[model samples]
Target: MKISIITVCYNSEATIEKTLKSVESQSYPNVEYIVVDGNSKDNTVQLIQQYNSIITKWVSEPDKGLYDAMNKGIEMATGDLVGILNSDDTFYDEMVLQQVANFHKQNNIQASVGNITQHNEEGKTVRKYSAANWNPEKLRIGFMPAHPALFIKRELFDKYGKYALDFKIGADYELITRFFLKEKISWKYSEITTTAMLIGGVSSSGYESYKLITKEIAKALNRNNISFSYTKIFLRGFWKLVSFLKKK
Candidate 1:
């Protein structure tokens, strides 16, 4: 099956090259790579243009925000499966997509989720995120599959819809909650790290963004008709803190 991977970016000249190289080096032959740039003021577009021959499609223009750029990339995807790889993240290895495709096709599933490692700008891993397995009920406690490590059948988006533009930070959480909890879609989880993410991403930028993400996640869960409380949110946050400390 052909898999289409989308990378969204803006003013990402420093890290875009690494992301592009990782996508380009994927061993999966039928992979389609698309890059959606938000009219970067930096040399990010010029750097992206250098790989024009390999990139399936690319566009550099102003977008409403990250989720909007992602929607544009998803709209351009023509493959059987679609995945989003943020500009600040790279695949764990060249075989990441190959494994995703093999496992997905072998099981005949609608979607796939894998593991991820959060790293510093120096490329040192800071925290690792992985679910023991796929559990829809875990949504009640703020657990979610690593967003960047997720690949869904293109038809799923056509059915459940894309990321909600209304959600500024936690749209991925909202979409995953909608799919697994509300719609009860079956997904295959591979115990493998698919993406190595840089830590200073949109949601994790600072204390204010973290608070906003937590609030947005609560909003997402509540809107999905899932019962979640501040207690559960803090319970989840406590474990994340423990994980970070243990990792450090």
Candidate 2:
């Protein structure tokens, strides 16, 4: 099966090369690697150009934001499965996409979710985010499969629609809710560690981001007609703490 991997970036000069190389090193040969840049001022586009042979398609232009760029990539995708790899994240190993393809082929599921390891600046793993226990019900508590580690069939977007632009930080959460809960998409969990993420991204920043995401999570739930409370969402912090303590 052909898998399409989209990397949405913006002034990602500091780390985009690693992300590019991660895809270039994939053992899966049918990957349609697409990169969408938000008209970066840095050399991010130049770095992407260096890997033009591996990249199936690339576009550097202005965009609304991260989710908007992702939407553009989704629209441009033409593969059986579609996934997003952030500009600062890399696949855990060369076999990740191959593993994902094997899982989907064997299980015949519409989507697959895997694990992610968060790393510090020193390149040490700090936390393991697993989707093994994730289910539709967990959305009420603000839990979700790691976005970078989740891959869905391209047609799902055509059927259910793309990410909601109304959210600043919770668009991913909202889209997951709509797909796994409201629409009831079939998915399976793969135990592979798909992506190795950096410590500080839009959602992983700090207390202030925590507050914003909590509020946005509430908004996402309400928008999807899912019953939830801020207290329940805040309770997810305990799970985050547990993940950090169980770092491998």
Residue 106 of model 2: what lDDT? Answer: 93
TM-score, every prediction: 0.94, 0.96
For model 2, residues 1-248, the per-residue Cα lDDT tens digits are 99999999999999999999999999999999999999999999999999999999999999999999999999999999999999999999999999999999999889988999999988999888888888989999888889998999999999999999989988999999999988899988889899999988888778999999999989888988998878979878987778767974
Runs with alpha carbons beyond 4 Å of true place in candidate 2: 242-248
Clashing pairs in model 2? none
lDDT (CA) per prediction = 0.87, 0.92
Pick the TM-score winner.
2
Q: At residue 61, give the lDDT of candidate 1.
A: 94
After superposing candidate 1, which stretches have Cα over 4 Å from the reference?
242-248
**Model 2 weakest 10-residue run by lDDT:** 239-248
